[model samples]
Target chain A: LAKTTQPISMDSYEGQEVNITCSHNNIATNDYITWYQQFPSQGPRFIIQGYKTKVTNEVASLFIPADRKSSTLSLPRVSLSDTAVYYCLVVGMDTGRRALTFGSGTRLQVQP
Target chain B: EAGVAQSPRYKIIEKRQSVAFWCNPISGHATLYWYQQILGQGPKLLIQFQNNGVVDDSQLPKDRFSAERLKGVDSTLKIQPAKLEDSAVYLCASSSRDRAQNIQYFGAGTRLSVL
Candidate 1:
């Protein structure tokens, strides 16, 4: 399992672009970076995932560099509903067992 | 097409009491996971199951907690003599085996409050 570090909190206004970065210096070659969004009183939902470079989805975008040591989740035109904790996970796909290790997560507050 | 389902959305019990949570994973999912999420913290993986066999349970408190996935469909998690520190949300998630990425679908979770 790889450990990830991210900002404790971030504040952004509605309709603005919010980028949350996570650092996983020990990321292995078989590891993939994944992001999840968790709202109050709800389970975390998958936002986006990337092995390297960038991957875009209907909800968010993920950017990874060549080193694979860090990745960023970009949310475009944020709204108040986007206020929630965002978790960055480094998961290994080679293993038969699959489970995510979540950190404290970055709490994004989309203010009006 | 249905997502994971969990029963007893909320539970309130006194200290030293026992509580059980049930989870029904999405159809055809081969892997299941149990996590514990405390207030102001992210969800922590408690155990992982592949069908009816246990994969990883390193973080599970075996002395007081027990879980089973009989017949490889639904799972039950029980905590004996709960403590105040055990007050947290228990989450259940599942994922398919064919997908290249480990994308897990989660349930609404069972919130346990130890009073």
Candidate 2:
């Protein structure tokens, strides 16, 4: 499993774009970068995932540079309801036998 | 489609007692996972199951923890002689067939308190 490091916490205002970056220097070729959002008392929900370059979804965007050493999660127009812990995961593309290894997620506080 | 479901939303037991949690994954989801989340920490994977077989359980304390996905649809996780440190939320999650692009859907989780 690839080890990931991210900020402990961050603060942002509503309607602003928030970027959370994660570093996984030891990522393998088969590994993919995935992000999850978790609200208090609920299970984490997948926000976006990317193998390289950038991928955009209705909720967020993921940017991975050439080195794959790090990736960024961009949430556009943040809202108070977006306050939650964001987890970055590096796992193999093989789904059948893979289990997620979660890291200390970055807690985003979307203030009004 | 219904999401993953875990039973016994909350459990409080004395040390040395036993506790069990149940999970029902999405109707056709072939992969299931159990994770333990301690307060102030991200969830740790305890076990993973693919259908009725064990895919990964390296983190599970086999000596005291055991889990089974008998029918490949519903599963159970048990802890015998629970300890105080076992107090945390046990979460169950499921994903669709395409593992790479698939998103994991999680249940509310079972919060256990071992005194």
Best by TM-score: 2
Off by over 4 Å in 1: A92-99, B98-100
Fnat (0 to 1) per candidate: 0.66, 0.71
Error of 1 at B38 (Å): 0.6
- Per-residue lDDT of candidate 2, residues B1-115 (tens digit): 7788999899999999999999999999999989999998888889888898887897899989999999889999999979999999999998875354567788999999998
Candidate 2 docking category? medium
Over A1-112, each residue of candidate 2 has an lDDT whose tens digit, in order, gives 5467899999999999999999876666766788999998888888888999999999999999999889999999999999999998775323343545676899999999
**Reference-based lDDT, residue B36, model 1:** 94
Return the clash pairs for model 2, or none: none
lDDT of each: 0.87, 0.87
The model with the greatest DockQ is 2
Tell me the deviation in Å of residue A68 in model 1. 1.6
Q: What C-alpha lDDT, on a 0 to 100 scale, does residue B1 get in candidate 1?
A: 93
Q: B66 in model 2: Cα distance from truth in Å?
A: 0.4
